[model samples]
Target: MFHSPRPLVAAAAVPIAFGRAGVLRRPQPRFNLVVDLTQQPFSKRWWRGLATLTALVAGVSQLAPPLGALPAGTPVAEGSDQARQEAALAVGALSQGSATGLTMSEGPLARPIVSAPARQSRSLSLIVSPGDDLARLLGRNGVRVADALQAAALVRAEKALPAPGTTLSLRLGAPDGAGQRPIEHLQYRARLDLELVISGSDAGLTVERRQLGLDRTPLRIRGSVGGGLYWALRSAGASPTQAADYLQAIGGSLDVGSEVMPGDRFELVVAQAKSADGRTLSGGLLYAGLERSGGSDLSLVRVPLGGKLQWISETASPEPVRSGLLTPVAGPITSGFGGRMHPILRFIRMHKGVDYGAGWGAPIVAAADGQVIRAGWTGGYGRQVRIAHEGGLVTSYSHMSRIVAEGGFVRRGELIGYVGSSGLSTGPHLHYEVLKDGVPVNPLGVTMVSRPLVDNRLMAAVRARAKALRGL
Candidate 1:
């Protein structure tokens, strides 16, 4: 049977009392402090009690130890040493005394009893780049300026730094309290047969050079010119430098691409410096030779000539004679040199040069190697090119569509301008003229000049040096 529930007494409230454990306990009847739980608007006592509970909770939390730490005399569980060490590190507590270490007064690890952290040395491995010296590289890597200079100087006492692209190893000492590191050890290859080492010591830095015996001899490489001479030389143990040097020396006289046939035997001798284990450390081409089965053999050797080493061939042929005057272009002479009736002016006038009937924009070449005196606009010649040759002689190409040589040297047979009726008259044609001492001369029926012969003494000296290089 459900009887009517007893009504809650409005005056009944849970009173607060402080106990020995600093916790809330039941209050006695004599205690006047009490709270009315059923009241909507809290009285002064409710607010005061809420504030007092919050303050008590915060105080308890502040006084409790962190999770990473332990209470005093708490024996660490067995086999949990590693975990404890990690936790201690997380809280930044040292196992030994340090100026910056935290003081855990009541934890399992007491103040001044934490273990000290091991000091670690720093190291850096660097590759020597282009434009980098030893001292600059070390200082850039965080070594003290003074220490870097000292170590670099010590290394230089034995030998200078290695060339670029060398790998260097450096070990730095642990930084001091002032946060400065010193170079402890440095090592790098100084040369093909020598190594430089700088080791720091209590006295000072000591430099040591370790050297190995190397065989410095001329190496010979021979092969067949089946496909390409350069690639064949590379496959026969010649470095790229040697192969390129060989081509520049040999290809200038002979067109290796066309003249050098397949199955032709080729020989190369180069300067080499090798270690004991048959490893080539340095080499360069000294002699490049080619023997053809059905043609003249070519042999070039490096010899001292004109105060410097130069490549010269013993079986070199003399250069062919070249004509001084070459026709600028092949076309019909529409007009001849000397005076004639002016086609545009309709009067008798002095026609100074000959005219050639050429296609529109036809190329015009220099008659002889000379400097271009004028290349832009002229009085009635439209666009003109004037070249001053040897012996006070000058050649001019006028009435051009465009001018190419602006104010520099132009060689014979080199294009100077294109034919056009730019300035004076007519259609597409070139008015060519030659002047001796600034006076106009006839362009046609002029005597051609011949090339000179090579000196007999120069040729004899060249042959002698070539034989010396071949040890004949």
Candidate 2:
């Protein structure tokens, strides 16, 4: 669908075709065409068909024609009551010429057509974001408050909402004087987030917060505590140009899902390739730092290790050991495990596990190192996945955009699925549940145990380095 507010041609009686050169092509002549007119003294179909044939043969089907001309086609009926009637009408129409001041071969009837509005010549574009109040954003851009509200209302009616955190584009026209061009229009995608209470009443509100940020030379990326990670970073001002580049460089280098936490932090050195005319072409991560929620930090340096680019980490921490309970998605818990009424169907049922709020199709990560037990649709769960962790502990994820890899063993941080609101869900959320011995357990209550880097050799070196940094 086009995001711009360009003029659209109305549905025409004669369908128009196009060519490889983007030019509108004329319709091909309908060979062996037939017409019937016996039933009615002056039949509309007979005249219309005759006009079409003439127009097609003349190569000006779009133009109107006068009455009285020859009918060029014959009818070959294939046995039916309607066919017999059609044959009679065809014979009658052929015998009579100009009986109603209209002839078959004359041409199409002349009818006045409304002219299209003159198109304004200007550049156009659209920018969409999550949680941006369209009217307020437009108002800030100098549009009148009333006009902004009207525009937003129109867009909402158009159902142009993109998935949460996903950016939807609109055509932007060049500015005219102090305001945007009259042809300019903007739209915001629709997105919703859910919040759950750990210990609160139904009449109240509970809020949990998480934040991830880092400002280092050459690179800056911020992760959110509750919204879709990609969307949050984008909304917080991370450029798509840079984020996409970073994702491309480190795509398989790390599992962003399992490694991300509410307080996760990141910093990196990015190198940009530039043109002599001061245009930036591309860039990639050169060095980086990432810290998880439990204080596990990984330093990344891209260097020629064995004549190949390799990621080297210094000051390795053991807190991020493969526990296999980590999920690829990072954000706040939107829905919690419990029996409640269904959001859409209003059915009373049990919802197992907590759901992480995120954009539809957001990548889902393996919670821990485990082999997949199930990865397919389950009735009300839509696309579901079950993974078996250590000690007979199993985790389940439901309602996914897709199962990337399924029914296969995976490490603690491998990509397994994507976020979605399929099945009985009303919006995008990662429905995650943990079960032990076929009984559900509160995932949040289970503490994630990590093998701290407390090795004697590593500890001694770290202690010595700390002492040296302190000038001891």
Candidate 3:
């Protein structure tokens, strides 16, 4: 190794001396290192040895007390500069400091360097599945992408999309939660990333599924009569349209107002719609069945006929039979069949049928199915309609109110005549009568056929048509 001159050193020490006058006097000490090889006659080898000893003693003295006791002409070695640097480094390593420094000036340090610990984990995750659009799913889950293109950009950046599989992952460098500021800590840890998964599989294809709940829809309502069938339906929240249809269904044979009794009840099956999120929107159809106390059970059925559905009476046949006549001007029937003797006639005339009392202009509905044979003002009864029945029976409505267009097949319940006191000893009352096989009989006592009498072939055809109409 090449030799170098001695290193120069300077030191200053101030001693505080106490004087007899009680005043403190500061005496400063000074030191400096100077090499004058030109003025020396000694060999370099001798100087080198001296310098090595001086360097050892000086360096060792740094770790001891009374550092100023070193000899007066202490020589420093050629590598004294490196030795001083090393000592300084050792002291620095023992002391705590703000700026971290490594002991690798020569090369990398031989000892393992320990680094500070991590405050939190940076891994974050987001889960997605099939049926979820990139933009929409991100938006709903508190992940934001400006638009479809931006969403695609995010997907591309993460290599996640389309096919159901693992999607995205991110190693964050800071602590985080939703809508929160991130911070660094030495003890806390968190993981963040996105995971895409296939929710379901069927026939070699992946599918997505979700569960949702729905709310109840509003109730429907309608018009009805008394605490009977109609009233029961109304209380059950049936709509007006439903009520009208129900009335039309049972109105034919059953007199709704008079037939229904107390304690009647009904049940219905309603249809409704649901939203994508499973919220009930509204309801529609109100199919129902009803039962009346002291009365009969009722049901509504849509009977098909020639590709069309029609409401038909289930309790009785839709057809009615006609076989009777009435006298004029019967305002209100003072007597009916099977009643006591007449108040005016006294001699027990034995009423053959129910009498309907009405004023001279009151119209009369046809009692049953028949054809009008005579319709005019006859000698005994003023205006009249004599309808001939299916079994050689004839009926007449006698009165002066007036007669409708005659000489045609009249259906049951058709208006035929008006009420009047003509050709009879009655004041505005209808003389109603029924005849069987051309013989007078009590109409109330006769049992009329419930259903229309049709040929077997025609009935079969009708049934087939009805079935087709019902689509069943």
Candidate 4:
């Protein structure tokens, strides 16, 4: 038993006051405890009470759960941007439509701290700046690094990520304890004809590509070759690729610069695709026509014939054999193949081949792709090389300075010999002769086979289509 003087314990009430402005002010609790011990200091009973309090606090701490690290969208320091943001968040906690706050869900330490929103989740507009990729845009806006990486990787799987200068609409879900918003849904224009929608859930992200409606039609354009055909097409709303392909399709022998006068009417039909809003996306040329007032019109079409797609001339005879022969040398005809006086012998005789007055030692290419059957020195034609082309058409090149190809196959335009007064020549010239079954024929004539003829039904179909394009 402890014998001591009695101690006094009392309860006090805090007084409330009213201001002169007629406002009621409530007083906060003033728990200023006063302990009056009537016994001497250092009592065993006092020590026992302190020990019990310490033990109770220790037990409570041991029963509590461990805490997880708080997620920070960015690094934080005093007087830093993060600090300012924290202050904003503090003020926003009391109001609606402000910076977000956090609320502990279930067990405080182990469970996640969900974002207690000021209002319902709404899609925020973010304009894609120049050179800003998906990951960079999302991360800069407080999205988790993990979520951004996952979304980007999924988009790259289908095609490259959307280019810059685009708009992305996103719905953000509640942020975790780490201040990063998880993506709820995102819509992006992956391409002119494609749209992508990305959705995120606890089970992970899912990506879907939706094809936009497209209107495909043949783009027929006709205009005068004012200034130039190329620029005229561009001025008439033709794409660069479409106009270039049209010129190339008609470039076999017809020169667009000199032959297509400014007065000529140029017509072009190209494959084009357009959006519902009338945005153009065009492909190569399908037909190119040149209408001339002085001469016959030139018309060309790219159509399938004999199981192969090939160029067809609508004006000229079908499959002209003249297209097969390539000029053996570059020079004007010095002598014709018909009867004429031989230049060297000075006598009237039949000239079997045409003579080309080329420069000395100039390159002489193969007339066409063929195998060299007869080469080396001949009777009168010095340094002669004879190559046999397909369809029994044999071409002989005489008066060459030297021969490089004696045997084996040679391609057209390959340097086979150099021009010189080798044999039967009085000057530096190339004597080109075309023979059919050992009989000399006109070298400039269409001396080869024609292309596979188009069927009657297919020709009718092509003609009808061309007529449709030619109509006003």
Candidate 5:
């Protein structure tokens, strides 16, 4: 029988049955009784206990080491070697402010060190000097002897070596273990329009010739004659060859030595040929003019006729012949063409020609258009050169430092030699002579004539070209 349940009490338990046999019974329900601590008189003591417990937990955490932190000498479990190592590393990092085998720094991270490789190639430039051949020049610039010789042989087989003052660009290989750097590549100008490139290694050498195109551009310049015509032209940006050509063109009418004075104004126009890379190749005078102080202005224009270029006057009037022979050198007459007391022999002798006193190496030019018949050393005349002109006329120049035109058809005012005292001479001077049929004669007494003008048809074209050039 189920008796009435006892009245619920503060600490009492209660249960209920389900089946008649009491096989299923309900569990006693638990009661969590919470009192109002704020209302209790001992509530302050309870809060104090909680505070103390929290303080104790915090103090223990502070005193114990971290999980991954252990002292170096601390013992560890046998199967926890890795864990022990990690703990030791952590402990070291904390103590030293950095991990083991690493330092804390305030800069970029260090990179791995590496060894530099050996140099394979280098570039160098060499200027050709006098008496310098390809082999010698390369040898002087640190090229291996055998390699230089082989390269020189290859270059000579393909083309002539570059002239003096020519710059050669070279690529050199690094020195081997034997301390030998070989020429790997060589480049130099073969001609004004051609360049030679040579490249090789230990295997063999290769040669290549490259052609350079030229561009012709017009140039005009004006200046006053100072010191001389050559100096004046050079001052106005004319090359030595151009200045000589200009003088030769006007030689038929103007005497450069005596007529050209200081302050003489001049103007010139030329077509200059330059390589694609801006190197000057050659130049040709298209027009030239000179205005003397008290004389009429002289103008010359280059005109094409009979497949050749000729310098003619702008006007139709026939070109005038030069009054006298062009002086060979710009020097005073030191000895006249007559008998004189021989300075060395101390005897009266017949001096065949006149002597012009000049410094050594002064340029001596042909007095008229002629062909060189003799150019070599003569006993008393020193280094002599004889040129045969038209109408059985011949001129001789002696005492030269060097002969420029040995045997060639030379025009009037052409450089033939430089003044020198090679043979019997007291000082540097030019002994000039004029001969008729191999007999010496007085040069100052004879007169020179100019050549005839071109055909009238050619002259018409020349006049037209001059007009167009002058913008008339």
Candidate 6:
């Protein structure tokens, strides 16, 4: 045990008494001593006295060992008579008040020992790379194999692991008795609005997921056709998906390749989900318009009608027009509308429509804007769909492998079904027909027209929405 020499210093001071005037008066021949054990050498007797005092101050039954027990180079010695004389002279000077104002410091070994500060844990930041998983990342960062595997299992169970290039915050504790530095905690962004935290010691682990309430902001973009429609939209901060939606909405009224010339202006409004930190998520176009140099401006808006999203014209009176119909399939005509020999029945019969020679599983789109009235298996036409258009005109598609648009209003160029050889057919092809007031007409010769407005109120609402989006 070690003890400071401050108590011994006070004990060596002279006594004081109070005088008649209530003032502190020192005794005759009073002196103050400041013994500096640090700077002056000491004899064996002095060392023994210090050891005895240390034992008494520590309340120990046994006295401390001599100062000779310390490491070599200590100033204390048993046979240094010169050192003893110097110490005696220092004590005599203190008694005579010769060192009243001097300060005495103890040797380095006689001072109180201080312990070093505690070690703190270190933190590391890591980024996930291509073809890397949680286990592999943790292993490479000096985590134990068992711990890495356990943490990976926990992350996989949540199914919220971040993609490549995501940053991960990790903390490593100090090395334990086994010389192993275990992971303290890890943090990662699981989604744009959610963050995942994994933490624990070697005893147990815990996982936490925090949600960030993000918001969706609507934006409007307007620009001229500088290089191309796609480039112009991209330059105006429109994503590829949003640009595609804009093109599809106005495809019925405008042809980008042939109709759009240089200096044609276009505008679009889109809604995008964004986090608090300005990270963009999914987005879609809400309205779009195109103004030609010398032609009518084409405007379209998306509206919620009958629990479904429908794109309609911005005009108040959307009348039946005859310019927006497209050919459903792209192939050569196999049969024309007229009397023909039935291949299966081996008899002459009147074919009311045309047949397209297309490969099996070829995409079949709508010819005009209309609503699907029938979508099911017909008598001679297996897997058929009939759509009612404007001017009391109806279009029917027969011999389809599958129907994608069922009982809904579909725009021109939107996929309706796939080509197949079903029912009374010779090979893989599509049987297409056009009808007027319940009478079958020649599909190849008949002109296609747009459908009339079903609900005036819906059209009015769509127009209002378009106006609002345009002003955004």
Using lDDT as the measure, the top candidate is: 5
Candidate 2 residue spans exceeding 4 A from truth: 1-287, 291-297, 300-313, 317-332, 344-347, 407-413, 452-472
Tell me the tens digit of each residue's lDDT in model 1 across 1-472. 9999998755457656789999978776653334454564476666766666678889999999886855675344346554455455553234432133233567566546455753567878899889887788888887878788898777666656668888888888877665667777888877778878888766767888888688877777888877778788888878888776776566544545456788888887777788775656656667778888868887876666546555656664456433445566546789888779988988988888889889998667777667899998897899999998777888888888898788876655566778888876769898999888888889775543433223466567766755554552
RMSD of each: 22.6, 31.4, 38.2, 30.7, 30.6, 32.9
Q: How accurate locally is residue 196 in candidate 1, as Cα lDDT from 0 to 100?
A: 83
Query: What is the C-alpha lDDT profile of model 3 across 349-412, one tens digit per residue?
Result: 6665556766666656656557788888787556767887766667766655677747877655
Candidate 3's displacement at residue 387, Å, is 2.0
TM-score of each: 0.45, 0.37, 0.32, 0.47, 0.57, 0.50
Over the stretch 90-118, how does candidate 6's per-residue lDDT look in tens digits?
Answer: 64334333332233357865553465444
Candidate number with the higher lDDT (4 or 6)? 6
| Residue 274 shift from truth in candidate 2, angstroms | 13
lDDT over C-alpha atoms for residue 148 of model 5: 87
With a 3 Å backbone cut-off (N, CA, C), the pairs that clash in candidate 1 are 94-114, 95-114, 95-115, 96-114, 96-115, 382-423
How far off is residue 365 in model 4, in Å? 18
**Judged by TM-score relative to the true structure, which candidate is superior, 2 or 6?**
6
Q: With candidate 1 superimposed using the best TM-score fit, by how many Å does residue 258's alpha carbon deviate from the native? A: 2.6
1-472 per-residue lDDT for model 5 (tens digits): 8999987765335455578886877664443233344554456655665566678889999999878955676444356555445555765334434234433345578554465466788898889888878888787777888888988897788766788899899998888766668777889997788899888766767888898897766677789998888888998888887787788777645677777789899877777778877787556878777889967777778876545565777654666454567789889999998999999889999999999999998889889878899999999888999999877989999989999999977767777889999899999999999998889999998787666556678677777766665552
lDDT of 1 at 39: 60
| Candidate lDDT (C-alpha), each | 0.73, 0.57, 0.51, 0.75, 0.79, 0.77
Model 4: per-residue Cα lDDT at residue 190: 70
Shift of residue 99 alpha carbon in model 2, Å: 42
lDDT-best of 2 and 5: 5
Error of 5 at 298 (Å): 2.4
Q: In model 2, state the lDDT of residue 253.
A: 40
Task: Report lDDT (Cα) of residue 442, candidate 6.
Answer: 84
